[model samples]
Target: MPPTLQSLDHLVLTVSDVDATLAFYRDVLGMVPQSFTPTGGTARWALTFGCQKINLHRAGHEFEPKAKMPRAGSADLCFLSDTPLDAWQATLAVHGVLVEEGPIRRTGAQGPILSIYLRDPDGNLIEISNQI
Candidate 1:
């Protein structure tokens, strides 16, 4: 028998304001709201960009609040695209999203890769990378 493997399901983030976070994800990154739920004093929102899903949960519930701003950039939720690197860079720039660094050419084990990085409204790092 072979082990089964599947695609990434979703990512959840603890946010300060659900509405503001939704707006940022929807308006800025072009994610669409999938659904929302409110129970007791807590709320959760599900958003989708293509097949990727991200859920936002309000901070300060059972979970500890996220660390103060200027957080250490230890994590990232990257987005991958089949689009050419130059076209993706131009599209991102047209939307006023700043690219922190490269589309620099680098060699991957397979061949070559091009990548760029940015941050979301909540300061989470985002990477857009593709193999060339």
Candidate 2:
């Protein structure tokens, strides 16, 4: 029998500008930013949302033994939002983040969802959605 995984823990991403990435995720997206020192005694930054987190590595400074071909703009991620889709659109508007595509009906793993898409500074596609 195969071992069953529990829930997603965290994921890593490479970014050209750590400051911009942190600001976008912290101020615009409302994720909490945190810093820590890894085993090598170097402080690193990450954003946390509930039980999950996203660790960011500066482009050209990724940790060793990572993905064979890690690169910025290669990540496309979705986040579940409890807020109404319209409210999300408004919040995004406040941040001057244009909706690349959005308010479109889509099927989530749980069922139907209303989703909107945006791109981060590194051009990573981010999908935010709410279940109906």
Candidate 3:
């Protein structure tokens, strides 16, 4: 049988500004920031939460083996949160991240979820949701 995939381990996000992307994910979304330096390679950053991570790559300086057309503001990502949607709204308000749309019902990997949509500094569409 072909090898079966179990779950997502990580993904890469190409952005114009790494620091701004790091700030949005780390401060606004509450993800932890990690820095690593591969042997003989430039330093890199990733945002980690709940056993998953998103690696950040500067748009014109992406590492090898990347997407055919890696570009900033082109990704749409959904993240699950145990925090209630209302509370999420409050947090977003505090951070000044506008809600593009949501608090609407949507399907998640586990089940039905209530979600809120926003955009990151790089204009990546972000969906934060809680199981309903």
Best by TM-score: 3
Backbone clash tally for model 3? 0
**How much lDDT does candidate 3 score?**
0.92
* Alpha-carbon lDDT of model 2: 0.91
Q: In order, what lDDT does every prediction score?
A: 0.69, 0.91, 0.92
As for model 2, its CA RMSD to the true structure in angstroms is 1.0
Best by lDDT: 3
lDDT of 2 by residue, 1-132 (tens): 999998889999899999999999998889999998889768999999999999988888987667888899999998999988788889899999999997899999889989999999999999999998
TM-score for all models, in order of appearance = 0.68, 0.95, 0.96
Off by over 4 Å in 3: none
Each prediction's total of clashing residue pairs, residues at least 3 apart in sequence or on different chains, is 0, 0, 0
Cα-based lDDT at residue 117, candidate 3: 95
Candidate 2 — which residues are off by over 4 angstroms? Answer: none
lDDT of 3 at 115: 91
What local lDDT score does residue 70 receive in model 3, on the 0 to 100 scale?
97
